[model samples]
Target: MDSIPVDFQWLGGAAFAIAIAVLAAWSKVFGKKEGPPAPKVQEFYASGQLADMGPVKELVESVGLVMQQMVRTNIALEETSKGIHHLVQAYEKHLAEEQRDREIAEEVARQLKDKR
Candidate 1:
């Protein structure tokens, strides 16, 4: 049987080329889409638009305050829910005790009527 000679150098080069082609195709399919870049602080200063920072700062502070208020409200709601749950349990226990007492009293009354 005649043996076919394999060239290692050609195989290595082909493998590298295929790897590069795969990477290029993958990037084209999944890379971030390009859009207009945001204006930098330097650009804003250069255009005499530095006054915009004041309103932006105020907006950030207001948002922070709102977030704090929401956190406090959530805590209050959780506490109220716990208190209501405890109250419901206590009321159920009281009702059960009253029902037992009423049943006992009715049984005693029936016994007395039978004795007469």
Candidate 2:
């Protein structure tokens, strides 16, 4: 018995062609049948009743309120930072004045000791 070598490319092409032919025949025998017509958009709104957009309006108003709150919070934080900066400046000034007073007192003590 002699076995012939088969080329994979030719075999794949023949298999694909047979599969396509079978699918075509199957669809011709049991294809989808046409049903009733789909309803049109005009039919849904034929009674002149508009779609309710109350939820959309409420969402926009809520977003506006959140933005306003964010602005107010930013302003408050800026004021707080400014107040902290002023407090640090005042504390530095107080320390400088206290050092100057201590130096003046030390000079006076030195002068009195030298006179004695």
Candidate 3:
């Protein structure tokens, strides 16, 4: 017995197209509905204009003062680091000078002993 050959590529394309069409129809029927129009920015702010914001304002001012103090402290810390670096450099220079003096004294003693 001989059987007819089926075209699987055409069948697959038709199945994919039907799946996409069903998904589109389902989304249109069951997806979220549009919400109300958003309020305008000016209107939104105007609605809350009568609310008291004194505490919020004072808190912001206190934060500003703290930030200023932090900036000053950072500047002082940088200056301290610079001063420490200078002190380190000076100590190193003093040590180098002492080493050179010791070397010179040793060389002089060696020459005098050779001459004697």
Model 3 alpha-carbon drift over 4 Å, by segment: 1-32, 36-51
Q: Is candidate 1 or candidate 2 better by TM-score?
A: 1
- Which pairs of residues clash in candidate 2, taking residues 3 or more apart in a chain or in different chains? none
Against the unseen true structure, what C-alpha lDDT does each candidate score? 0.92, 0.89, 0.90
Relative to the unseen true structure, what is the C-alpha lDDT of residue 64 in candidate 1, on a scale of 0 to 100? 100
Best by lDDT: 1
Worst 10 residues of 2 by lDDT: 43-52
Lowest lDDT 10-residue stretch of candidate 1: 2-11
Which residue pairs show collisions in model 3? none
- After superposition of all CA atoms, the RMSD between model 3 and the true structure is 8.0
Q: Cα deviation in Å at residue 85, candidate 1?
A: 0.6
Quote the positional error of residue 65 for candidate 1 in Å.
0.7
- What order do you get sorting by lDDT, best first? 1, 3, 2
Model 2 C-alpha lDDT per residue in residues 10-104, reported as the tens digit of each score: 88788999999999999998997879989856642576544655677799999999999999999999999999999999999999999999999
Tell how far residue 74 is off in model 1, in angstroms: 0.5
RMSD per prediction, one decimal? 9.7, 7.5, 8.0
**Scored by Cα lDDT, where does model 1 land?**
0.92
User: Where does candidate 1 clash, by residue pair?
Assistant: none
